[model samples]
Target: MKINFDKYHGCGNDFIIINNLSNTFPKDSENQIKKICNRRFGIGADGLILINYNDKFPFEMIYYNSDGKISTMCGNGGRCVMHYCYSNDIIDNKSEFLACDGIHHGIINDDYVKVSMSDVNGYEKYNDYLFLNTGSPHLVKFVDDVSSLDLINISRNIQKSNRFDNGVNVNLVSRKNDNLYEIRTYERGVEDETLSCGTGAVASALALNILSLINSKTVNLDTKGGLLTVDFNKSNSKYTDIHLSGKVKKVFTGILEL
Candidate 1:
């Protein structure tokens, strides 16, 4: 079988996106999905996304990590999906779409795509780190310099520890200024560090604010891939109207045979 797919990346977090409105792709084909995401042998990507039909919304986003397992909400992937929908004429400048987490609103402005993220009720403050769920669970730790740390070793140790039952994405953050910060993330599903992570960015920003490390509600994150902006409104202990914005690019389109 030959399957057509389009590739897009939001700040270097790339995905293989397929228009599955016809329900042609099997959601349970784990092995095939894994092969397709293989870097050396297949079309390399951090994950795969399917834009499927929806009853009440413009579309539904189904995501899978490179490991071929269904995963939680991915912020960068969500932004890429929104851009794909808009570029394909499936949605206009603004629309709502459903994902693994819940429904989210998206908007397109010039070259950037802004999406509304789920509200965070609160976070857990640990001795050295902060834990929160910004669509996905993440553990954020402040560091002196994000570039000097051994990310894989540190993140692997945390993953193997008893701290989290399922596992958690680990984020190493360094504050550059009140509004600017640098982040490096080890994603749970990906099981490694990618160029960027949207949900991880959100989690880190919220964590920083909770600790009073930053002075503004709007924060800029410098990921390995690119820069992303997170804006939110805090009322008491809850964060609402959270938005993640960044540039998304269509890399290519191709057909793969299986």
Candidate 2:
């Protein structure tokens, strides 16, 4: 079989997107999906996304980790999907789409895409880390230098801990200033350090705010890939109107044979 796909990346988190409007893509072909996302053997990407036709929304986003597992909400992937829709003339500048978490609203301006994120109710504060769910579970730790730490070993230890049931994404954040922070993240599903993680960035910003480390509603996050902006409103203990914005680009398009 020959599969046509478009590649896009938000920051450095790339995805292989397929227009599955005909519902012909094999949803259960985990091995094939994994092979397609393999860096050495296939069209490499951090994840795969399928833009399927939806009855209630403009489209439905079906996301899969590079490991071929249907994973939780991916912030950067969501932005890329929206941009893909806009670039393909599937929708106008604004769109509402269905994701794993729920309905998400997105807007595209030039090469930048902004998408509304899910609200966070509260967080669990630990001695050195804060645990929260921003569409996906995350453990945020404030560090002195993001680049100096051993991320692989640290994330491995955390994932093995009993604190989380399934496993959690780890974010090592170093505050550059009150509103700017540099972050390194180990994503759970990807099971490695990604260049940029949207949900991880959101979790870090909100966690810092909860600890009074940051004083602004809008925060800038510096990732290994690039810069991302997160804006939110805090009402009591609930965080709402969250938005994640960053630049996304189309890398290339090709057909893969299986």
Candidate 3:
């Protein structure tokens, strides 16, 4: 069996997107997706996305980490899917799409996609760091030297710390200017430093704001791969109208012989 797939990226967070609406994939396609995502043996990618047809939503988003397990919501992945839908006329330039977290309203301004994220209600403060879950769990800490930090080595220590059994994405943040932050993230499922982590960026930006580290309309995030921005309104320690904006472009398209 051959499965047609398209590759896309949001701020360097790449994914293999398969049109699963028709259910044309085999019963074990999910497992096959894992193999394709393998960096050493197949088409390397950060993750995989499945766009399923749904009656309640314009489309359904199913996400998977490269490890072959179903994962939670992804910020960059969401934008990638939105762009994929628009580029392929899955919906339009603007539409309501369903994500793993919930309903996401988005608009495509050319290649840049800005998406409204879910509301965040929980915030935990530690000795020197702030933590939050904006669709995905993250730990954000202010750092002095992000570029020189051994993110892969140190992030692993905190990412699976006993405090979080399920695990958490760890982000090292530094205020660049205004509301902009330099961010390096250790993803939970990915378990390594990727070019970017969308939800991690959102969580870091919001946490930095809560800590009074930066104040601006848009939080410009600099990641190892590319740049992403998070815009939102804060009132009484809560966030509203949260939007995650970044780049999503097509890499290529091909069919997989299964």
The numbered model that scores best in lDDT is: 2
Query: Whole-model Cα lDDT per candidate?
Result: 0.91, 0.92, 0.85
* Tens digit per residue, CA lDDT, model 3, 1-258: 888899988878889998889977666556776788988988989899999888998898888888777888888988989888888888888998788789999989988998889988759975567889898888888898788789888877775567888877888998677656789988877788888998988898788778777768578999877889898888787888899998888999998887
Report, for all candidates in order, the number of backbone clashes.
Answer: 0, 0, 1
lDDT of 1 by residue, 101-187 (tens): 899999997569999999999998655889999988999999999999999899898887787877889999998876889999998
Between prediction 1 and prediction 3, the one with superior lDDT is 1
Q: Among all windows of ten consecutive residues in candidate 1, which has the lowest summed lDDT? A: 122-131
Task: Tell me how far the alpha carbon of residue 236 in candidate 1 is from the true structure, in angstroms, after superposition.
Answer: 1.0
After superposition, the stretches of candidate 1 with alpha carbons farther than 4 Å from their true spots are none
Candidate 3 vs. true structure, TM-score = 0.95
Off by over 4 Å in 2: none
Candidate 1 overall Cα lDDT vs. reference?
A: 0.91
Query: Candidate 3: worst 10 consecutive residues by lDDT?
Result: 24-33
* lDDT of each residue in 1-258, candidate 2, tens digit only: 777889999999999999888887875788898898999998899999999999999899999999898889999999999999898899899989999899999999999999999999999975589999999999899888998999978998888888776788999999887678999999887789999999999999998899898888999999999999999999999999999999999999999776
